[model samples]
Structure formats: C-alpha cells, structure tokens
Target: MADLAMPEIALLGTSADPPTLGHQALLEGLLQHFGQVATWASDNPMKRHGAALDQRCELLKTLVESIADPRLQLAQDLSSPFAIATLERAKQRWPDRRLCFVVGSDLARQIPSWKDAQRLLEQCVLVIVSREGWPLEQADLQILRRIGASPRMLPMSVPGTASSQVRRRQTTEQLPKCLLPLVLKHNLYGFNTTNP
Candidate 1:
C-alpha cells in the first residue's frame, strides 16, 4: 500500500507526428526513472507538423499501445499553447505524483522563452534527454541551472532523427518499426503503404 502513495511521475510531451526511435528510447528511459510516464502529443502553435492535433494524439496512443509497457501511459493533448497550462493540468490529474517534464536538449534551451517559463520550471522536475548529435554544452547546462532548473539527464545514443525529415522523405525512406503500421494504414507522413 505504501507504493500507492509514493509520488513518481514524468511527462514526455512531443508532437510525436509519427513517433520514432528517439521517442521510444526517451519514453523507455523515463519509464525506468519514474513510476508512470505520461506521453503527451501537444500541438505547438509555432509550427505545422506532419499530422494534425487529434491525429498526432491518436498516433501517440497507438505507439504506446504497441510497446505494451505498463509503465508508459498516454496523456491528453490539452491543446494548450503554453507548456505551463499543460503542466498545471497534469498536476491536477496526478495530484499525488511528483511531476517531472522531459525535453530534449534543443527544447531545454528554448524553455527560458516559453510562456510562464519560470513557473513551468518550478512546477516540476525537468528531465532532459540528451540525444546523440545534440549534446548539451556546459554553458547551456549552466543557463538552465541559473534559471532554477536543475534538470536530470536521460543519456542515450539516439540518432539525429527529426520528424520533419521523416515527413519530407516518407516517400523514399524507411519508417520506424512501431510507426510503420499506423503510417501505412492511416497514410500518415505521406507514407505509401504499397511500396513500403
């Protein structure tokens, strides 16, 4: 019963346009670090991704289901422009859990400019997934530290795979294992199931 009361949660929010190997590694790593992993498919106002909001959310749900890891769970897209808003909602839902927000190094650097950035940083633990090509420099790391964000790093050799690259080259390139089926069936990322 003690386990039920322990607060351990981590949020891995992304567009997850189709999800990828990088996303998988990050989620798996988060699963190990926390009692529950909330994978959110958010729609960023800044960019138009491969899929729409609901489509991306559905893809996330599908990918999570395929992995079948009990530790990994899906969170609502919330359609909130601000990460702070989503964090607030996440806090309300998991009132008993210690919330941690996971971001890649690039996003980590951009956090300072996000809406209510400081509040978002203060709301929960910041977990940074330092990917292969985009290593976090000490200077940037210091910047985050200066902002009162002592982020924990989830180190892994995730290749420099971007969702944009996938969408652009979907016609000729190979799809990630987990996303292939959904991409094929739903014609996502402009993937042509016939040749794939």
Candidate 2:
C-alpha cells in the first residue's frame, strides 16, 4: 500500500516513570500532526527511577493498543541515550517520509543540557507542547532557529501534574483515576494498590 512508504512518527522521551497527564497531553498534540506516532521508552543511565526498560516498553504497547488509528505504533530501544536516535532510526526506517520529534515544554527548557542537542534538532522537526508555568526561553528559541527546526507550541491542560509530584502524592495523596492503572501496572511513583 502507498501508506506504507511514508511513515510520520513522533518520538516521546517518556521515563514512563509512570506516564502522566503531561506525557499524555504531549502525545495527543503530536497525534494530531503526524500520521504515525512512535513513542520511545529509553534506557538512560542517568535516570534514577520510573518504569524499567521492559515495563515502560510494555506500558507503551498497552497505551498504543487502545488507539484506533492504524498509523500509531510503539518502538523500544535500550541503548539510545538521546531521543534523537529515535528520530535517526525513524529516518532510516522511512527515508522518504516526514518525521517529527515530540516533546514537552518542560523538556524543551532543558534541551541545551541534552547530549548532542544540535545534531538532534537538525534531523527532525520538533513538536513542542506547551506547559503552564513553563515556557521556552529566548536562548532555546535561538538554538532551535539556528538548527533550522520549526518548533511549535501546542496547548494542553497539564497543570500541576509532574512525575515527581505524582510520586510524592502517592505517598500521602490518593492516586488519580487516570493514573491508577498505569501506576499499578508499573508499580511506579511509590503507589501502593492497597492504599493508593
């Protein structure tokens, strides 16, 4: 089929450290722009907590399963330190197509801190979802412009929910319904089924 030739993908750098509303909002925004969305669950030596590589991968599979669109899929990698590798792999897998890397504004704020950020930006279009209380800085925009990345901002209701906050809430606060299944399945955020 002609559909198979050009596969548009959006790579989400999710720790799945218990995927939260922030991650969901980012993905939903990307889903609107691309025909295909491939979420990347990475194994970063630097990350301290969240779902293990296999658990995060499985969670991504579960999340993708409910999507009705045939274009959406999940990809797993245990070696890629930067999300850019996902972009590179996507390009290699679908050389003739358009691909974009999806990220949250929170991460966008930290782009300069990432490994090989310039090279990453050069390879893919960036679809950055805006988060409340956090916006991209002039320096970030300058870097993005320098790399020729058409950075975009998408709006989503991702207020005070962050993985660390979620984790702390699990200790003393009730687990929100939307995050319950994922927390239980991944045993993340210190969420105990018996209590939370």
Each prediction's number of clashing residue pairs: 0, 0
Cα lDDT tens digits, model 1, 1-196, are 1133568788778888767766777777777777788887887767787777788887778778877988888877444767889988887787788777878877767888788887777778888877767878888778788877877887555566777777877642434576677677778776766746
Which 10-residue window in model 1 sums to the lowest lDDT?
Answer: 170-179
Indicate which candidate wins on lDDT: 1
Candidate 2, lDDT over the whole model: 0.64
**How many Å off is the CA of 100 in candidate 1?**
0.6
- After superposing candidate 1 on the true structure, give the runs of residues whose Cα lies further than 4 Å from its correct spot: 1-6, 77-79, 171-174
lDDT of 2 by residue, 1-196 (tens): 1133556566666776555555665566566777677776677656676557777666656655654367666666422767666666777776776666777676776676677777777777777776777766778777777756668665553554676666666652322345567667556656667756
Give Cα-based local distance difference scores for all models.
0.75, 0.64
Q: Point to the candidate with the largest TM-score.
A: 1
